[model samples]
Target: MNAQDVINFLQDNPSFFEDNPDVLTQITVPHHTGGQAISLTERQVSTLREKLAQVQGKLSELVGFGEENDSISAKVHHLTLSLLIAESFESVSQSLYTHLTEGFAVPHVQLRIWNSILKRPLPEFVEVSEELLFFAADLQRPLCGPVQQAEVQAWFGESAEQLRSWALIPLRRDAQVFGMLALGSEDAQRFFPEMGTLYVERIGDLVSAAVLRHIG
Candidate 1:
């Protein structure tokens, strides 16, 4: 009666085709490329081929994702080993900066420690605005996107103007946030709200543990 009804009837009675093989030759459907009407059998074959191509394309996409994850995991592993062997706060900073900037190719790194326990008046101990400290404390996960705070951008010093994007990782010790490690790049697309932050969050965890050793 209707196209859907015919489809349902054919689906329900799959043996109908085998019982009436002549129907396959009589039925003709428009060709996928839109020229002549082809036999139903030919159309079915064409449909299956299209489905197979789509499945293969999806499989290739999945393989690409797997390779990307493996690569990022390896880089994170290398950073872990580098931090594990660091002897002091200075070395920890060196190893973290070196691994992220050189190994991961992040162009700029900014670290700020706000805990009063940081007795040394190093650059890290430089005063941070209460607003920033609150923002860091409120972060449940790493923030990835265009620079969220303009003031934070100025912390990068001379490169502030050129840095258009940022990944702000909140460092926490004993569940309390203490500081932030900011990664900066000139490319706006380098960091965005929709981007995955799994590895960046992992970096935050590693950095927090290493820095807390001396200042916590």
Candidate 2:
């Protein structure tokens, strides 16, 4: 019989090996590593071992991801505590920069508030393009990917050319977007399109609260 026919027969007859016990022991398959021919049972055991190893490898990868998420969550909590103690708008900005750049390892950050009600504003309250403000308002979630907004990219100063990826988060006041927090990274894969933005969104809300306390 052909190889396919034999495979079909074995698959169709589940109890064939029990019925022909001698034939099961007598059947030989080539060794996977180019060694001597091994019995069908040895090959089956070897295949199971390989599958188990693959499953173990996948489990270890998942464990590594879990540990990474835990570490990031701890960092976010630390940022939240720092923001809580902030007594001024500048204090809030300083704490955010320290936490994101030092604690979270993000290198470039730019914050621009277009709708602040303050009579006098620092560099943070600079006027931006109407189009940029509209774009920020359109975002339902934090946008993560290659840099798309040219006007926002110019806000990074000397680091603008070096940045390969970006995360744009809208800061909301009164459920309306009034500002944006831009984070830039040199690594192309740092802020990929598919990356999760849960922590990013929380950071945006924290910054919004801090800013709104003084200039809402």
Candidate 3:
């Protein structure tokens, strides 16, 4: 639970400790006492208090973490909305790069579109890298960051250090790939199979619609 949640829970359930008076063994019983002796020792109670304090510290950390996560999620949602509002490939790509870097905190990304009928690359192409060009030729749908070192090395040819992780999303209309989005990051573990691809796929759907609207 987050810091606020943990704190609220503790506040509401103060009886959790109070009900178990043996938790606070500060008082000692006489040798010939009429009442039952407490099982917990003074040192044990002190340790429990220390443990509770640690839980409180972790709760505070979770509070901060929850806030950061919320911020990131909001930015991503905004970017997705902007993508839906875009009219052209240029606008979409610009907004996407800006959102990736400024909004989502990603490092770098490249978008490539291949017009099947025209047999030409989009205007955005600035001498496509050999690896990217090859990837496009393969026309893989929804590629994620490589896990193996060899795969990673191949994707990032010469300036591999500049890019760590990447996601290649193919834009298709009627099952034909017309464009691709290549997202890159400096962190190797950013994109993985365990993560959800719903957002990227949604972006792909928009890209595909845009491509058909523009070219068809």
In candidate 2, how many Å is residue 107 off?
Answer: 0.6
Q: List TM-scores for all candidates, in order.
A: 0.91, 0.87, 0.55
The local lDDT score (0 to 100) that residue 209 gets in candidate 1 is 90
Root-mean-square deviation of candidate 1: 1.9
lDDT of 3 by residue, 1-216 (tens): 789997998799988667877655655543333465554464466568889999999999999978976876687678768877888656777887798778767666656566544323444443445565466557555677752334334434565566767777877767666666767777778887566676677667766675565455
lDDT for model 2 comes to 0.90
> What lDDT would candidate 1 get against the real structure?
0.89
Question: Using alpha carbons, what is the TM-score of model 3?
Answer: 0.55
TM-score of candidate 2 relative to the true fold: 0.87
Q: After superposition, how far is residue 88 of candidate 3 from its true place, in Å?
A: 2.3
Root-mean-square deviation (CA) per prediction: 1.9, 2.6, 10.5
Write the number of the candidate with greater TM-score, choosing between 2 and 3: 2
List the candidate 1 regions with Cα displacement exceeding 4 Å: 1-5
Residue 17, candidate 1: alpha-carbon lDDT: 83
lDDT of 1 by residue, 99-155 (tens): 889988999998888874765657777888999988899999988878659778888
Q: Supply the global lDDT for candidate 3.
A: 0.66
